[model samples]
Target: MTTENRAGGAPAPAGAAASSAFRQPKAVWAVAFACVISFMGIGLVDPILPSLAGKLQASPSQVELLFTSYLVVTAVAMLVTGWVSSRIGAKHTLIAGLVLIVVFSATAGMSGGIGQIIGFRAGWGLGNALFIATSLAVIVGSASGGFAGAIVLYETALGVGIACGPLLGGLLGNVSWRGPFFGVSVLMLIALVATMILVEPTPRPEHRSSISEPIKALRHRNLSLTSVTGLLYNWGFFTILGYAPFLMDLSPLRLGAVFCGWGVLVAIFAIFGAPWLKARFGTARTLYGNMALMAVVSLVIGVFPDNRTAVIVATITSGIFIGNNNTLVTTAVMSIAPVPRPVASATYGFVRFIGGGLAPYAAGKLVEHYNAHVPFIIGAVTVAAAGVVLSTVHRALDAADQEQAHAGHSAQRADAEATA
Candidate 1:
């Protein structure tokens, strides 16, 4: 793939005025705002996990189901997102997702039982499935400066949302566990309104993808390798997100603060650090080093679960690697897969989410059966395995990164010549 295609499949013709990636149309900004809110939903509940467990008389395992239901549903639902968006259009698909999130999040806030909240979260997940899968395509299709700029913008939204979600959750969760849920409902409602008003309807693709296309895309080895690497890495990622709270005996506000710090690092690394590293070290080498560091960090968390300061430091530090890894992996998947971009995205989402959906619940079970430390140990091991998995696909990833680097140099040389 060329550097332009690696950016997110949107490319500009040669010598076209390279517009500033930051300067975007009203529609792009609107969708980006919505993307921020949508992603916030992922970490919004972090501060409230302990609160929910205590209030509902549920166990850690039960509370962890909130992630499982949401992610599992989102994973399965990803299979049909391309089909739905193709038929109804991107604007409508986004609207439907926002509506579902608004309703179900509010309903979850009112739930009398953990079971009820879990069920509502599943509904929310279905909506997320549609919105997330289509949002990238919409951004790529609509934005200026080609695919790279759009993707950076998209990743920026993701980073900002993730960073803020915990802070919002913490502040509201201090009042009540339900506060975060209601908060998300209100915020997403606003996002929905902005989207409806600002984003023009997206044109449908000439050939709508089949429902089975994502699954079939997995037949390609590069896509499969990337997917499994993501899955294993996520096993560690969710374990930290879901289980770390139990180890921290701080108030909801304090836990939220800790995670917010983590999120800040994540956003910074994803938007700035990831690209810098990839440009300097190459994608495969960067990933190898970062994944190894993550394994060490997870092991530290596992070994020092009772050391409050150590745990907090490790947790926040983990965000750096997570953020870098997320950007690199997503970009790599988009670039390396031979299938259509939408199909590749859907297929990648479907496969990786399996690890994300299952990991947290498994973390809970491991804690119940073994100990808190044991779960982190497992998390460490799994993340290490992700690095090993990436090694198998090293040739493909390296080639893609090398091409991108060369293309970037060529572009720079051309610009210099033009100025001269």
Candidate 2:
């Protein structure tokens, strides 16, 4: 039950902490496994976008509504996730989320038209908001390692799910556009069962949260600034995720392969690359450099949209930066925000998902009215703007890094004493 410190009683290095991230309890793993499936919903429909447009007789903008509905609903619903979970407890909240995803995803699979599928996806978004917010709280509350380790573990699941989602979508979309939807329904059903059985019951919070708390949390400058920056970053992130497939002009299978490669880099960097870079350069500097690189990558994609090879390579390359940003920014928000974790999460989710929700549809419209290059050029600008917003909080980022390090050391000492 105790983890010893390194020689000379120094706290374990990042490598040791990372290794410990995986050595978690069954309950944690159960939730983590469910987290993987829940995250899969984000990219599960990606490979099917073009297929949906063709088969449903919908325009690309209409098809893009799939992202719009899901993410917009998710953003709005995030305000209530903490309230719901606080009243019902984390276990029931998680189950409620899983159940909704199962029902909605299955219905989406059977929908007769683009409009019907978009509606069902909106319902799916509601479930995602409830599940995603609560899962982070549960993992941070119960995981064996400290906050940093838990984040690493959580991001690992996100990376793996993202990586796998496109591949699964491709294989299934090749069969039928509905295949990915049905696949998610079945998989989420299984994850639901596992979560219900393996995860222990959790009591409701002693102080129930109001729906307004997340919004109120935003009054804190650090929380608000980070949330705004996340919004800008997501504008670029979702532009690529939502709109890039049409440009690829590949088969569903091939598009899946491309995104799967991107996801692989996302996973690798999230788990390993991010922590190493943060330790070396500090959070602000790491994010500055990473976001700049991402802006450059987006610019390349914008300039060379007609060149399939260039687009593919740049898209995949962008994943490394994306992965690093995802982990580091989330960590920074969790550490620096002067509010409870759930509230901070809900607030941040509310802001960021809005940009994500809106970007795909915007991209579609831009392409319709202007050239293919316009949306991505705009995406590159928004990401570069995110870096600028981040700079205003450089001192806060340094403080968060120091705070996390101190927390880590204190946790190690506690474990060492308990063992002795």
Candidate 3:
């Protein structure tokens, strides 16, 4: 449970005995703020989507596309953000993403139609993909050791932003649909300034020859399994969060309370559950177990929809697994390629982004054509497939790791014999 800093051969300070958690790095706080801002945009519409539908003459399908389009763009862009970061560095990416977010957010506020608004949302995603991937690099690069905790904390805090969005949006909905965007834009501007001032530029590693190398490395068990796992969780995670409000419009309690409940579960469990699961089971076991847990809950929701109580419970419980999904994925990618963890993280993000991108769009269409229930069904199937992919990848990676260990021992023995 303890880590030694490779820098000076010293044990890391215990988390419980930390003089302060806030002093790790200025970039840590900046990245945290950036996460808050990115996630705020996600949650900002939950309270108001139905209302926006009414005013914009948008159908449920149309409204959901807002999220779908953004995710698609983000997924596609995430592939290269790490490469771009390698060229320009994390600090530059963070600053640039912030600027684009600010401009696009302002444009979103002024958008005259649903199409324009969706386009603006896509712009935010473009900026956001760069911002998020780079910010992650910044946080990881900041630490001497023990960056995993910080990564989990970042994901957990994002749950808070998602949680707060509906409540804040609900309160502000009466003002205008534009109110949340404008307000979030203001907050983003502050984060941008704070990030620009506080985040020191770090040295960029030389571009690795042939970006294809990272993609090739992903065939290893860890990265491949985690990416599949991430995609599965995201597909289901959005199935619940992105579509729940629309689904809950069918219930008596309405969508606001449902989103609040879902968000709360994600935040609470992400903050508390992630570290416990990772520590107790070890990353691979936790990653494997949670996929099963998620699949069960998602199926339960699909099967028992008439019982609103069961549906709510199933939806919220899923968040517990989601809390750790990103961490598992990020950590696994790191093991796959320790030297260029940023590139590994991006590749994982990109793969999952593809899944997340499709979820909303596919779910929306399914809701329009088949029924609202169809989204969850497909999501459950996707998660099961993810389980298969993860299992295969994990087995493969463990074998490779063991092989490398044996090779290392052989090399050491030969060297010692030669010296003797």
What is the clash count for each candidate, in the order shown?
0, 0, 0
Candidate maximizing lDDT: 2
- Global lDDT scores for all candidate models: 0.85, 0.88, 0.68
Off by over 4 Å in 1: 5-20, 406-420
> Which structure is stronger by TM-score: 2 or 3?
2
Candidate 3 accuracy as TM-score = 0.85
Tell me, what's the RMSD of every candidate? 5.0, 4.0, 5.4
lDDT string, candidate 2, 1-420, tens digits: 112232223334556657878989899998999889888888887888998999989989899999999999999999999999989999999999999999999999999999999999999999999999999988877886666778899999999999999999999999999999999999999999999999999988888889999899888888899999999999999999998899888899999999999999999999999999988888999999999999998899899999989988989998999999999999888767767778888999999999999999999999999988999999999999999999988987887666455423322121223222
Give the CA lDDT, 0 to 100, for residue 394 in model 3.
62
Q: Compute each candidate's TM-score over C-alphas.
A: 0.93, 0.94, 0.85
Q: Which is the winner by lDDT between candidate 1 and candidate 3?
A: 1
Compared with the true structure, what per-residue lDDT tens digits does model 1 show for residues 1-420? 444532344334322212344678999888888889888888999989988999899999999999999999999999999898878888999999899999999999999999999999999999889888888877766777655566677888888898999999999999999999999999999999999999987777667768988888788898899999999999999999888988988898999899999999998888778877877788899999999999999999999999989889999999999999988899888767776677877998998888898988999999899888998999999999999999998988888766554444222121222111
- Candidate achieving higher TM-score, 1 or 2: 2
- On the 0 to 100 scale, the lDDT of residue 271 in model 3 is 62
The candidates, ranked best first by TM-score, are 2, 1, 3
Clashing pairs in 1: none
